[model samples]
Target chain A: MPEELPPLGDKVYLDSAAAVADIPDGAVILLGGFGGVGVPENLLAAMADHPARELTIVTNHAGFGERGLAVLFRQGKVRKLICTYAFHKSAFVFREIYMAGKIELEQIPQGTMAERIRAAGAGIPAFYTPTGVGTQAAEGKESRGFGGREALLEHALPGDIAIIKAHKADRLGNLVYRGTAANFNPVMAAAAPLTIAEVEAVVEPGEIAPEAVHTPSIYVNRVVLGENLELRSEA
Target chain B: MNSDPKLEAAALTPGDIARRIAREIPPGAAVNLGIGVPTRVANHVEPGRGVMFMAENGILGAGPRPAPGEEDWDLINASREPVTAVPGASLFGHADSFAMIRGGHVDIAVLGALQVSARGDLANWTVPGAGKGGIGGAMDLATGARQVFATMTHLMKDGGLKLLEECSYPLTASGVVGKLFTDIAFIEFTEEGPLLREVAAGLTAEDIQRVSEPRLLVAGTIGTLTREPEAAEPGA
Candidate 1:
């Protein structure tokens, strides 16, 4: 039988020192977050530590300073950062590298990025949004009307592997996430080719009641358990 | 102020008025700058005090101006204008970004204006000649800002002054305007609304009135014009 997503544990360690994606170089990783608030921190750290290079990161801001996706930029692991909002809090090192043309960057509007992530998770090929119709985001992208007003049609994203975070998970792969971390994890978990999550606690199967599970056991692949959650860590 | 002046020592040129507008904005305020002349304001924001900027397309703590040959193609402004994301900036989803604007989080909004009548109705972004200017977050900012400031030429594109009895275009936010920094003079919306706040260094009230299409309320006390930003000169 063809494998969908792996049903692993709800609770797993999202430690960069422990386990994470073994993504081959030149792979596309769809990063999910709206600013650093919803970022998968531990997963990001693991990716940073890994030896992989030439990554095309699909993210909004890619984080700023010494934290989040900016670390990847500092390491030169990213070949491209495909997203918007480069003006507000870009990492200093990332800016220097990008200015040097050491990497390729694809800019998308803030609104379009959000809708595209939603589209990928929902299994839709493409959807139109009224956000970027008349501006530069509409450049080369197709435009159509939904309710008389024009909206831009953005393509859905399918990644080679999906990394995410959770607050608590059962051994059966059921997950529950806290506030801001809860933003993109469920959808990201559902849309990737391989979905791995790191959680603070891992309990026995059925230990987490069906009512409390944020993500069902059907979508998860491998579960790495870590005891203490890093400051806002995820896949 | 009534029109009809030949020449005077206090009259300011259009360029000088640009200078004055630059001095009005504070050094560090979380700003959502509107397009057109307001975009020019970013170049003048003093470097390094950490002014957090918001672009509805999803950036916080946005940087100002890119160094020559340093433009990050993957990172841009709400206009998709090539820009550099500042240190400590973060990118996120559109919804969360808009939440900041709609939630009254931005400190101030500086935008361009097409018309500012004696009664301060702002007409910018779209003027009907242009198709669907896409309000984007302009409406959110106009009403959301702790203060709404505008920068524009004193006249219409057809050589007519943009100052009018009231705005000809659709209103974005009624009575939301706090100040008007123009190329001719510095005006503000007061309890009386759209009162003449200040005159340029080399300009007089009568000179301002002559160029303005509409009548202006003269300031009771003569005020001085602000100086344009130094960064604007470098880019220009």
Candidate 2:
């Protein structure tokens, strides 16, 4: 009764642009990174050049030091951003556009933002937290007392696409990250409908040790190998 | 950056303020340091004190910035500045890091403040006329930490007291701050109000009171905060 699934081996994309070609207008996307580490540079490069418009970007911060996401923001592709840290020391472009009211921002607490994405990946619909009790963040959210403290009910946030980076990816899509670059990438890889990874190396199935795989292959849908990845533009 | 030039000369140096806060960190306490001046507290922490540093960016036991030419770009603090992991450091995903914060696993949170009310309310995330600055992890730290310490200068550049009877700026959390450390003095919050605990060298109770917006109480055991023995004297 059901159609057979596509062959599972050799999931590599020819290039970053080809990997993200199917993302249409008005889709909600999750970008995996904190500051600049672990960001999918080649994937963001592709998104910057793609014709998609009015997209909602959920990221930890507007890309820092590097011109990765800021390039996309400059090109006027992002319609709304759901982020915890929208302002960075080097975020002049994002600040100018935000101040001009050209783009929308839904600021969230860094921890809550991370948990919301993690919850979606874990199949949890909502969770309660005491982080925003009695603050402006709890203004419209539902709340009830838990134990002795009041907790705000927060919903899980799912995305249409998750663009993440890893140090290496096996042909099976298992991933591994380096040091602090592992911050949000693993959780995001499982929280979206279409999980696309831009990794530095794509190895054979047995090359990536099973113990080192931070993201198991089941959650990954696409893999793009990034060659000579440069977070900043040459120009 | 201060609008008030009159009090600019009297402020304590950022390093001295960090030393003052570091002295309060008890051994074995897991502390979260907010961005800006609070990050400098890592530099002033006495070595082998066993005070663990937590960053919202999923790093626990974060050490000082890496040595020149030894920097690892992937190992950074919440400020995105390169740092080394201490001996017991553990790296985790963002969700677990916030779980430590929101779940009250963190013992202390030292944060920079724009304004602190006499009622112990805080407003440090954004300026009044400035567009919404990112909240980051302040709200979570303010609400979740067992104790909150606000490290800031006593007065704004405009000479306005940051320690106020009521904060005019947007609030980060209400009744969350337990202690206040400024260039001029150390004030502890009580049900009755802010009680002055220690004053910097040469400044009298009257001098501190003049700049304080809320009524400042001279605690029965008020002590003088001394400069580091290794440093030069004021105006030296």
Candidate 3:
């Protein structure tokens, strides 16, 4: 919303993300996905062309071998990662983060993480829950009595641009998400500095229903056609 | 109403039941101890049994307490308390860790409970407006572990029962728990029903019968709750 970068016609909007080749290294990025599903492979591949090193990432899954947002980690672009489950990529992500002491990683309890993100999106500011009151996750965190047990105040996540993939989007930017891909994209779109979505198809504004829209156009800034439906369905 | 036999003991303290459940575990078993009373079992396994403790956040073979000057800053269990790993223990992530539990690789799972219903319905997981459900892995373990046991105080306040003909608490697993080890008695669950093994010392069967919420099926014979070993006195 800056005067120089009014939401529309902003120079930052490279006709397609390819217009600018140099993104500042070590930038914080939030990706949406679980495993390989909903991954923005084209945008990720585009980002990979440049050596974006030491980047901090927020995501749900580490992806499977070069498929999930983890391709950035494999490319050695991520310096830190915040996630719930990394079982699929633990051999590299866990060992390197916890064992080898290479990158800093924070693993959130799954259900708690889901609620925390939802809380942030809902503008609750701060709230307490008794989920991780006594476990290791409780270390270095303040806990207060709630009801009869204890709850901890886990801070809401603040991100740089949040990048997501959705099934389709209208020119106005209202989006539709399909299948397993809905994991973290919807919540994260509103929680970041900027949300860029890559869609399988783009149609006119009225094509999508007002209620069927998972993310309204206000939350989405830019949309790029990444792949055709016929080609995407094959995968 | 039915000729119940579990009310076989005299009187039992909370700590007595905790210690009894602790002793029941054999050494070298892969164990997942649930929160609350069962967590205390970490202190009671037999010596030199090579017990491997597992925490859901991906630690295996965790030892009770870390040795002096041996604390590694990075090494900790799900509780985040300083801990030592048993010999040959290694690290794994959530998927592998859960696969270990659900894959029937774990030998025993000890859980805390509000109630073990007559039909063996476990109601532990609590929902916000619904009640309590830490659910963690309790649901998976109930049906997965080779042995499942419950450790808790027998009766709730207000003269109510934690063991009922049917559970009032939300059930995580149905008919999967093997034993109910409580402050007052020992019960081995079966298709025939909960057959009582031992009762608290000093309390008569009549006293227990009056307190039991459901009609507990009686065992053919009764045994006395075992006393702590002689060496246990000095430590106390």
Candidate 4:
């Protein structure tokens, strides 16, 4: 009898480093996270050791404290940051480099940033939004009137690679997230040409219900196991 | 009004401003509370009001900070503080979450401000000399919400007036603020400009105007602002 094949062609990778080994220098990386949650810490650690340089990171905020993206920022690997929030009390690493004029910062309204990324994934070239009309954020952008209100044109924000974290994933790379950790992962999963997911667990192909999948298998290219660093409050 | 101890003591506390804003939120409104003082407004909304709290980080029907053992780091608000989800909460990704905000689905946005002009212009996210501070969601919230309510102290830390004829700081949005709740008064921005609606219990209309750079139009019946007793602590 012929050998039976694994269902759905397993996309799971046992090593995080190997999953992200081919990311080129100067790549535009879509990192998924909002604050400390939903960050691919293991993948970031791997990238920190990888020989990539001058990467352009796009995310919600600069990394909080000394973990995740901070590791990349500390190593002087990033060339520019495209984000909504760049400086926070704990984002010392980003603040230092940003203050020293060593890295470039392109700030946009949070909603605009999210929509631009979504547009990239959905194959929309650009869209108009009323979120920054008449403000400095609208400066230098194309403007048109819509429904009697002014709107500003924002372009799509695409990425060469995406590194996201999820609570669980099937061997086929379908993912599900826990609570708000779902923030940018799903959108980014579709926005990048090469997508890598760091998940808490990788189950068999049929383990995760089809309806429960937050990110479909088609958008993900690789999956690797990562530690759950969720902080526990003192009871 | 140069930092008079007596006036400072009489000014409403941040808690008072939050409660005042909470009372004005219509029942069943989908409200987005900005970080800091605006976040406290959620704690003061009366139960059964059916107000849905939306956090920009991707949760609707956001609830209070989770009880000690129940906290989930994955469940956090815009401030990145661990939070809980109300029973009927819905979670989404960043794109969809922001769509609701910029699409005018959010009824109200309660935000903090650095300065507010009489014409309802808001200056919040950054100071003039301060190096590029984070923009976050302020511009989106200021421009997209059906109504924008700002909460801030009446005076700057150095005794400069925050209720100005025109904001000197860079604006978050032009003519976006619908109402203002400060430490000393409640004011509304109308077609006729700023209308002083209420004054703190210990203050008079003149006291408010003395510090306001804009000429406030006094309401026909200016109500006295009062602070109700604090509610029981959450998760106590």
Minimal lDDT window, size 10, model 1 chain B: B1-10
Model 2: fnat (fraction of native contacts): 0.66
Off by over 4 Å in 3: A1-235, B1-11, B67-73, B127-133, B226-236
By lDDT, the better pick of 3 and 4 is 4
Better of 1 and 4 by DockQ: 4
Listed per prediction, chain B TM-scores read 0.81, 0.91, 0.83, 0.94
Q: Estimate, for each residue in B184-235, the C-alpha lDDT of model 2 and write its tens digit.
A: 8899999988999998877777778888888888899887866664363221
In TM-score terms, candidate 1 sits at 0.53
In model 2, the runs with Cα more than 4 Å from the true position are A1-7, A232-235, B1-10, B130-132, B228-236
**By the lDDT metric, which is better: model 2 or model 3?**
2
Cα lDDT of model 2 by residue, A1-235, tens digit: 1156534566778889999999999999999887677889889989988999899999887665437888888889999999887776577788888888989989888878888999999999999988777777888999999887788899999999999998899877999887678778888998998999999888888898889788999889889888656552111
Task: Sort the predicted structures by TM-score, highest score first.
Answer: 4, 2, 1, 3
- Prediction 1 global C-alpha lDDT: 0.64
Model-by-model DockQ, in order: 0.05, 0.53, 0.03, 0.63
> lDDT tens string, model 4, B86-131?
9899999888888888889999999999999989999998877645
TM-score of each model, paired residue for residue:
0.53, 0.92, 0.49, 0.95
Best by lDDT: 4
lDDT of 3: 0.62
Q: Which 10 consecutive residues of model 4 chain A have the lowest summed lDDT? A: A226-235
Cα lDDT computed for each candidate against the true fold:
0.64, 0.83, 0.62, 0.87
Question: Candidate 1, after superposition: displacement of residue B121 in Å?
Answer: 14
The docking category that best describes candidate 4 is medium
